[model samples]
Target: MTERVVVDPITRIEGHLRIEAQMNGKQIDAAYSSGTMVRGIELIMQGRDPRDAWAYAQRICGVCTLVHGIASVRAVEDALDYEIPPNAQLIRNLMIAAQYVHDHVMHFYHLHALDWVDVVSALQADPKATAELAQSLSNWPKASAGYFADTQKRLKTFVEAGQLGIFAKAYWGHPAYKLPPEANLMAVSHYLEALEWQRDVVKLHAVFGGKNPHPMFLVGGTPNPIDLDSDSAVNASRLALVQTIIDKMRTFVDQVYVPDTLAVAGFYKDWFYRGEGLGNFLVFGDFPSAEAGTNLRDPGSWWIPPGAIVDRNLNEVQEVDMRADAEIQEFVAHSWYDYEDGNDKGLHPWKGETKFDYQGRGGPDTPYKQLNVDDGYSWLKSPRWKGKPMEVGPLARVLVLYAKGDEATRALVDDTLGKLGADKRALFSTLGRTAARTLETKLIADKMQSWMDSLMANIKAGNTRTFNETLWEPSSWPSEAKGVGFMEAPRGGLAHYIVIKDEKIDNYQAVVPSTWNAGPRDPQNQAGAYEAALADNHELHDPKQPVEILRTIHSFDPCIACAVHLTDEDGEEMLQVKVR
Candidate 1:
């Protein structure tokens, strides 16, 4: 017998997602992932100047603050065939690397940690034992018995006030929560600590880009100028502060974030056995060598190489060509969008269209239940690489690195598996996904010092140029051009494609990371990453509170992560969230 289940507002913050899973008795038979909210950012870029695309595109998400801006600027630069100064490239590398470290750490502790760490279970823990467990994992300074006691006390107060998620009514006592009381207490404490650590880490963005959450960017370079004597520009003291922030990031990721992930994984060893959706992975590469005349297309020169691993075949890594229209395409068959051509065939971003077609998607006679395995259910288009669904993000990047015989990455993977007491085949599951994010964070954090030293050395050598003025004029006369700006965002590979005509944006398409992982099924009936992962190895302990579902979904660290709208079957508003 098969049953259907609906989970709306799958994320807790800025997104509107709905998941419907078909259950065969106790296990999920099939699952459908949907985005209820429309993304009109691409259409918004229709008539803007190509140089200004980054500013408008950066607002596409409430999180991943600076990724869109980076992609936007890169798109314009690629179209112009402009070469930025080495200093400018160095600045961008530092900023992008900092984003990886800051975002991964924040996601691990604030957003993803709660899925594994039981807050209510912590109150039952003895503070001293929690401290002992914490000390055994890492040498972080805050792991004192008294420190845990204070955190426990604060938590108890919140519980007594009936304010701590209504005292664990938020799946606190669920049977699937396997962490011991002491471990749970330790996790909860770091969750609180991470909140503070993130504040200092993002200051690096402010120094270079002028602010966090949509940091400034330019078509050929970053916004900040290198003026050693000026107080307002990226001066000596500011650069020193950047190093401090990088150190702070390395310390926390090493002591708190990495240890916490491994510790949590030890308890959920079974999760490492499943959730390998699509068996394919993709990475678009970022952080190119900050040297003059470096070939951007060469994977060997990139810090994060661009490549595709299809069918988990580690030996044969397929090359990714972003400029090839046939290689990467987005399908709208099951999405709430239209195309000049039929929806069955996918359109590459260069020729992508975003006309919202809600004719049969909603309004009266709309069966809310029909979203279960139906067409035009989601607002996200299914993006495919060479006509197949692929998973992207830290796991994909790590797997690509390991497969390409990167020794540092191989060691990290082996050490992680050794600590967990499991083999490497475990790298293709839910637990492995989470661990990959942590490992990637450590790798990026360690690499930040190199970028910082390069920037410092360049400044000392009197190469303080942070922008190229050669291609600043629109009349330099390439009346028409098109290009792709791609990056390895914390979530996965993100790219912004732009078509320029008469120096204005003729068409713009942003194939974001979330769209790649959280999109709906294609006409070929290939399930997206979320659907395939959920349908693989999950059983419900309680249909009412689907903690199991959250465990797997949260593992992806979704960007459409949200504030939900609960309406009646008749389309009547039941719950409204307003900002007043």
Candidate 2:
């Protein structure tokens, strides 16, 4: 009999999430992904100065908060038609690159590694054999006897540190952890190393901005500029240091990260074949330029198995409209907000009317009204994709980039696939999604270093210009304007749409990464990114310890911290608020 199996609060990932799997026997028949927690971020932005939006948006996610800040600024700048100097552009690129690497390393080692590589399993690993394995991989950090010994010492130190933090909450001894002891030891060492690396890299953001978590990003340009002679600019010595870090990163990607991913995939080949979510992809190109009327950072568009499906071929790709997509609308039907369900509804924050009344059932009375409300769920709003659920983040970006291949990207793709014993076809599956993210990280990192070097050269050649001659007053603003600023964040495409009036933000809306991944069902009852992925995952061995769930979700690098709230009566219904 097909019955519902819910994996609420899926662990070891960002944000609060629940996956309801329709099960027949031991396997899953279909699944629904839901995240309804957190409240009032967008609504809080109303009536505030447009510049303040960056400050508030940064609070979206502690992990990748800077992306939100950057996106916010970009939207306002787009609306205002202002441009910054080349140096500022380069500075922004470097800041973003640091965050990308930091997020990637942390997610790999701290967030996702424990599932495949066990810590306790290390006790059984033969140190000698592990050393050999490392040698065979060539140039791996853990290959040396000292590194292995240091790993043991550090493990003890972390244990003594007595703060596993999220790891403490992890199911370490669970049966799903299948790595050998030696492998576990190596992975554990990498995990600790990654944390340190991430901490150091985050400082890059702090150096330019005030803090790390949510660095202040400017709209027209950087509020500050590097004085080449003022000790802040890169001298011959500092440039060397930055270059050195890039070199080391390249080495790690080539010798350690790439090799390790491939090596681990050998053991978990099952992931390559299964958990293939709706195989459609979308990418709004990233990286903006100082020049106007030029799409310098053009989107190399591509789609694999592209098309929309109603219900039968539910795994096909579909684009849910952010502005008017019925599946994309917010409903106060069961939310805490008291409003007429028909006309005076949960207006988008740009036109929001906030009147909180938290009295409702917190759950839907029937299956047909699943998003109305439910009990025990938090206050976050629900975002729907194509009236159905979909998956977002890296997997989506990779698929999108691969399909829209330029000569440069195609070369990288071919080389990466051959090394992993994968072909173009295999990339249309779960493994491809994971591998694409790793590869893209390296690609973007290399490009960012180049951009930084170019900027330094520009400054050395006597160009101190960082801002254009543009007015900042109300007269500088347009009477009525609409524009969207899109960028590929560490997660996925993040877009912000703004409508301004007399230098004030009249209506501001944003599409965050989680809204793409974890949205609920829409009016036409379309599944979102996560829901589409879950529905395709048929082999769910343990609902309580769903390793498959973790793999699929992490492949998207789902970050629900960016999601905001909706008032719900039933408590089950969650709406995704894209408030400024």
Candidate 3:
């Protein structure tokens, strides 16, 4: 009899997942990554105003919800042909920059660090020796005895404060977690500090967006008023504080992010050589300029290995391949849908339908190899990147942007490489992706500051009208307007397609970062980004210790909240699948 190994309630992610690995002898023959639960945000968006979609979309994922808000608004605005003002663009850019910096720091230190560094190990490190190791990297954040002492006090408080989720049953002394105790203590101290920093940086989103974990924004323009009646002046004092935060963040990134990554890399050097999933990447560009159709930092020229991997041809990508729609379509073939088109053939999501039936694949032998409809594994529909499995996330975006090679991006990249003691050859691995994010944040931060200054100049020059009145009548919307808004979110390329009728959302479709990273097998039966990375000969010492897998996956920073929704009884997935 064939044996099955299952990993349920996958930890260190935003949602619930179950991994079923079919082990043949000592190797994994096949693996199925299943999202255990469903949340239907799409179906619930059905009669809602297009502008309101941003509010609901942002709720898709708590961690990267701002991206959802941005993408949703961009989509609606794209459909309506609305042009936001220059000042509004700068504000959006700044907010996005803040999110990128805050998220990257928090992700590296708190979420992903536990895999490599042991907390308990910190108790044994000589603070002096650890400080020495930290010193070699650059400006070392003081790892003196006093710092470690304070770290111990903070960790103890964490334990006492009953907020141990950050350190839940941590494998502090595990073999894989091989950091010096002092180094560990230093990292731990910053871990607490990063929490506060993240909270502070997220406020940038709050100022523009009503709140985070989902923020309110406008399609035609920003919600914050900016006319003579509105008192929207740049708070120089507050802006100075933000500037200070950016500076401190730059120091932390230089001292802590780079150094910690390197320190951890010394032990986990294997990741550099492995987990290079798909090699093909797509970053649809990010942070559009004040002028429409003018790419300030062209994503077409990325720093990473560039080009789409459909059919395995490596070429510079200037535009989206319209042909991708010709071959790829989401499959309910194995889904609970009983409708004709559920498994019939490829159809665009706007025209896609869902139906439910629990009969499995339908054949004499089908029952043995069929998917259950009653309680399906995931609410997410499988999205095929060019009719094949592909990955999208930090790595993909960085690579795509690097390949495009905008002057600003390349210059920033070179300076960052100089800092990391790396060359172009090293840009294709996990370490490269990790290091690139921090560098990108700094570049984006500095650029945001420049953009803010430019905005103020434009305002002083007496130009405050940032929105165009493009209100189209429902009847005047033409036969059908099919438009796509492509943006680079914190994870990677985010896209939205909208088809409207009678001032109502007829069909609204999105391909989120997770849809690219965590997708299942397509018609070609290829491995997804995560699957391909996991397939790279993992040295599975313990089934419970999926640390390596966590590192590879977290490197992508998969966001499932916006990408999933369940179908109805006939196997048609619902658009709005909630956590509760």
Candidate 4:
């Protein structure tokens, strides 16, 4: 008999997610991914002023807070044909670059590392041996035996007190864990260090946007005012502070994050061969130059180019046109939604509907043990590019750049692949997805300094403007306007579609990265990225633990909170449970 294993509310991710897999003994026969909540942000955006949409949209997720705000304003600007000042563009680049470096590092160390590094195994590690191993990886200063011993002691306290806190509820001694004790100790030490480092890194966002977790954004340009003499504005002191934060980000990524990933990866080299799902990849492209008349999606000007790669082919990159009819679409056939035409039909974002037509096992009052996968299940809608399921995130973005023959991307990717002793084809698997995030983090972190220099140069040349007031009024817009605002967010490609009529939002739909990677099966019964990857040659060392399943899903850094945003301020809370 085929056995089914369920892992509900997968820990360490941004939102609630449940993964169910059908197993033929030890190997996975098939898998299903479901988002348990429903988001009404799209419906809430309707009939609101387009200028204020960013404020509401940015609340989609507190983790990826700023990305929605940036995409929202860009959509309004795109619709109005409004152009921001060159200085404003440079500032936006700096802010976004900071977000990528900050968010990617956090995801690797805090969210995904636990799946690979066995914390209980760290207790068996010799501090001296761990220090030696850490020293060999990089010149990170906290590699002494004393540092390792202290972290081990702290972990021991948590375990002894029967309160692992953040480390609680993990499958402690799973057989699938491949890291040695010393390596686990090293990763755990860095994990704590990353927490402290991130606190300082977010200051850069506050310097530019006035705060973190939901930075302020203007439609035509950035909200920050540049005044070298004014202490209240983005003056010389704040500019220097931004540079300092950038330096710190570069140091941690080079010294800690990259080195730790390689060290752990050396022990789990087999992961390079598994979890390669939907070889098709997509990126909308971002990081526009401050130069006059530069297009954001222009391959030559963008730091990360926008394109699509089909069948793992790197010879030619197909252009991604969001505005192209039927180029991008969402399917709700297997989702908890109903389309105006039919559940089987796909709808473009501009004409997207948010009708909730849930027909699951229960009527939303009581929860079911498992989702009814045959009909409507997930709140997430399957997103496809030109009728093909595509993977998005760092791996996709890096591959697109590599295929475009960008010098920096090719060199970094080639060097990393060489160090791993893996071929270019290895970039298609779970390990590749994890490693790509580190490589892209370094790339974006390094570019931040150059952007800072450019911003300062523009200010020195007497260009201090950061906002364009000409298009700030809704009266300046046409009676009807529609546009798409897209960006390469930390998780992957994120776009917000907006339809405005008479200066208010007629309709708005946001297709985030998780929607593409974690949605349920599509209209043609095509498995989404998460489901497909989990079913791709996945084997369970112990079905009771299911660590192998997490390795693949966490590699995508699944963020279902972006997909479904329902919350109850006053209601009976359900007791959380762990399923295996």
Find the candidate with the highest lDDT and give its number.
Answer: 4
TM-score result, candidate 3: 0.85
In model 4, the runs with Cα more than 4 Å from the true position are: 292-300, 362-367, 562-580
Indicate the worst ten consecutive residues by lDDT in candidate 2.
296-305
Local accuracy by lDDT, each model: 0.84, 0.61, 0.62, 0.87
| Rank order (by lDDT, best first) | 4, 1, 3, 2
lDDT comparing candidate 1 with the true structure: 0.84
Q: Give the range of the ten consecutive residues with the poorest summed lDDT in model 3.
A: 294-303
Candidate 3 yields a Cα-based lDDT of 0.62
* Cα lDDT tens digits for candidate 3, 1-580: 3543556655777776556555565455555565545545666667667767887777767787777787787777767666677777777777777788888888788777887778766766676676666666667646666676767876766666766666885665556676667768777777877787677677666656656766667777777654434446334444555566667666766667766766666665556665665666665667766664222224432223224533223346535442256533565443333336435455565565544343322345324333332233344456664565556666565555555555776786777667556666565666666766666666666666676677667767887655545655556665555445556777776776666666777777666777666665544555666667666555555555656556666676665663464445354545653442
lDDT of 1 by residue, 1-580 (tens): 2567788877553477788878887688888888877667776788778888888788788787688888888888888887788888888888888988888887777777777778988999999999999999999999999999999999999988888752244677888889999999999889888888998999999999999878999877778898989988999899889989988999999999899998999999998987777789999998888884224555577888899998888998899999898889999998877887799989999999988665344445545554735557777899999999999999999999999898889999999999889987788888899999999999989988998898898889888998877766788849899988898998999999999999889999999888899999999889999999998788887887787788788888888722234434344545754322
Candidate 2 segments exceeding 4 Å error: 1-3, 153-166, 172-175, 232-241, 289-391, 562-580
Model 3 spans with C-alpha error above 4 angstroms = 1-4, 24-29, 140-142, 156-165, 227-245, 293-315, 322-324, 327-329, 334-339, 342-344, 354-377, 407-432, 469-476, 562-580
Q: Which ten residues in a row have the lowest lDDT in candidate 1?
A: 561-570
lDDT of 3 at 418: 70
**What does the lDDT come to for candidate 2?**
0.61
